[model samples]
Target: MALLNQDSDENPTPGPPRTTEAQYVASRSALWSGVSALFTDGRGRVVLEDVDYRPARLLPGGAIDAGEAPSLAVAREVREELGLTRTFSRALAVDWVPPGAPGYPQGFPGEVIYVFDGGILAEGDFARIRLPEREVTGVRCVEPALLPHHMGPGNARRALAALHARINGTGPAVLEDGRSISPTCLDDLEVLRTPRKPQLWPWHTGPAPDELQVRQSWGWLFSEDGRGLVLIGQDTGSACLPGGTVEPADHDDPARTLRREAWEEAQVRISDPLYLGYLHDDTGSQPCARVRYAAAITDWEPPSLDEATGQTYTRLLATPEQAAQLFDWDSQAAPQLAAVRAAREELGLPAPVRQQLTELPSHRPIQSPAVR
Candidate 1:
């Protein structure tokens, strides 16, 4: 046979071609990652750092350096930016961003983000912060619902989701483009999307004076856990407790009105309502009282249309503090605290803490209940 070259076999080995390590790495796409910390003021407000380079503020953190762990990267950034030494173990959320996002220049690779909980900061912790001379210009503590006014949309979404994740305590929220891939009922309902209307009206404990007309009935309805129920108006986007205007069928009894309205709006049956107090509504031409009650949920029926709104209201559960914050009642903290205390005592529960709003799951839809 004719002499064949040593390397001239008719068929090459059927396998992928081998390459140098450098060549292999170069063949794959490259991406970067960033880390952030969600620090709260223990009063339901998030800590945001104002940066000189960026128009919008951000949570305390920065990019991961080459060959650095996500946790280490955040710790380094916190030390460099805030002059504080802290370690983070809890991951609240992880978000994946694609390239070409707003503010990201062309040719920049996409990035992954890890958000960690910094725990609630006290007054002393605030005193310890030392901002860098050039990079950071200021710092602010803002309510979660107001984050959009201070941050870019994506950053706000990420931060809000992270806050919810921290409160959920179930696990980290997996996200894409700052939105949860699998969202909770609260997230699905977009609770707190609208800022609560601030009310500075005085709160009165015990029954209203006979002269003051009882115009409305509302409650701090509670679940087995220490969470209170909040109803988001389908038309107005405003949040309020599950109660409504006193109707004739209610027979001038605010408690009866509250029980009926609660069932109609939320399809939730509550125990005998305990009188909490009332809010003096003198904003309009006529002065009247908006009665408030505290009750524990006994049963949850299937979702149904709220006859008053002609739609199903978005029902969410939040801690007493979270409810107060959502109600914009922080300024009148005493009354909010009082209501919570009375409610807990009535239910034989412990003190409530700040937590993420959660969904009150309902089964299949049912026909709208007849309005009483």
Candidate 2:
């Protein structure tokens, strides 16, 4: 029987309410937005959230409510998700995810996400974390190296870019999709490289990335007078800095390698090592990153390298002008030399020592190439 006034042979229900086409269009025209907060644990580890209903891990924060500010929305989500009552410190970045990604379901529009700095958590705050069982299944502290696996490409970029901006004090960053605009902040950005032949320092294809490459560490030994130390190759009469490959025994510590190299090549004890930076070299089939450090000679003994294996070196000190003349601006040692001056100036040390042109070391440099 027809329920509503015996209408035809089909059963009918109550009429539904409706909205005008204008209202529908107004809603679809503007894109949706959300926010996430990056909470780290004093250490370089970040807090990642595992949603019960999703496969990918996300930062803790969510959607904006009607007529609510994004900042307020993020604070509310953080409160709801982490069981805390706190707002974000400030926004770290803004990323716009355009529509038409295959990852999204059919007809699903894209979104703009704002990432806020959730300030490093103290020990007490970390202990108080309580995940909402309905939305969050688990929470884990992810190291910097492991972030790429949890957060998708876009989010990982946002997190890392934000972290770098914070560390380098470069202010808030801006990203579209996932890459930095204008001044890219990649730490290993190749601005200067040695002009070695055959393959050259900066590969035509660019430097090989960290994951699948080898690393070498060196110490730019310096004195208070801004004089730098060099090790003269006994075999070839070439002048070069003290450094060597990052052996597996060093346990991935560049500083350790620097200390070991200084001791092995020159019998010099360098203290207070400050990492200057690196040069990404692709002069060979195996890509290499020559990590440079600045250190002051605390004490020294006679230079030592076993002559039995054709590995003997003599330590020599060069004034800044002389060193500059020795390893010109285009040499691989340029960054380290420049860094030595910058570091000394930044530290408010005395200016580099000046020496006459005749004081320059007279050495036949057959080949002073980067350590293989």
Candidate 3:
């Protein structure tokens, strides 16, 4: 067969050359890609770089070189920016940002940012960080709740979402303009966004003294597995055990208060509320005793709005160790560990291995009974 060529025709004049698919695609709009990593200290604070040229702090990373893979780019950036040699094996999040976002000037192309998991930095690792004065002037470790103070709205949101995605142990979360495309359980509850009040009060394995008033009651309500229940506050987003202050209806019994509050707050029915000692909280106006208990979740109905908080509490299952971390008990680790051991023994739960927190998704809403 003869080759078909318009230019070969006797009467034909030359026309513009046809463009291939690749050539046409190359002419279309392209998004710039930047790579960053999420590093945390032992206390779960994120490591952010203070860029000299930018007002807001940013995650430790930089723009990817042309034709560079994201993983390689992040590794290079870490070495150049933080003066640390590290390799990121997994991505925590991928955010698609539009033009005109912060740090992107008008008419600038959009970007896709890859946030990799930098893993927990130990004391030795922190000691090794050397900031290159030209770009990153300094470094600061900010608590997840305080991220907004240091970062722009979009960057803060993206960083928080990435942290929760790592805690959930799920694959990388996909985001658009720094919002989750499909919100995960942690995202839905807005975990780590709330500043959790420290519970460093002295934990006593002995009985609570009678002179001190019992003002609060909380439980490590366990499921069939070794996981305990945690309630994410609707108003404040703080995570706590599914219990509250002692109501008049509790009749001076802390266990009764725990059972009633668990039912009212999370539609959970717990049984065999075993005493796990008390925390002597003296920070308030007067010294008060906050009794703790360990129990098994016997049954649970669909979750409804907590009459007290006026919104449904996001319920999660976590190991006692995870609960301690969420409650910010770093300084009280010894007591917290003792309490966990007590809870496991009392609830007959085997020693718990560290596991990711998971949600108790219940769509059907039931009427919350009056506090009793």
* Candidate number with greatest TM-score: 3
Task: Give me the displacement of residue 156 in model 2, in angstroms.
Answer: 2.2
lDDT-best of 2 and 3: 3
TM-score of each: 0.74, 0.49, 0.79
lDDT (0-100) at residue 286 of candidate 3?
94
| Residue ranges of candidate 2 with Cα displaced over 4 Å | 1-28, 187-372
The superposed Cα distance between candidate 3 and the true structure at residue 289, in angstroms, equals 4.7
- Writing each residue's lDDT as its tens digit, candidate 1 over 32-96 gives 79999999875668899999998999999999988999999999998889888999999999998
TM-score of 2: 0.49
What candidate 3 gets wrong by more than 4 Å, as runs, is 1-25, 122-124, 201-215, 247-253, 277-289, 308-311, 319-325, 331-372
- Each prediction's Cα RMSD? 7.4, 19.2, 6.7
Give the per-residue lDDT digits (tens) of candidate 3, residues 321-359: 667656665455567567767767777777756556877
The lDDT, on a scale of 0 to 1, for candidate 2 is: 0.64
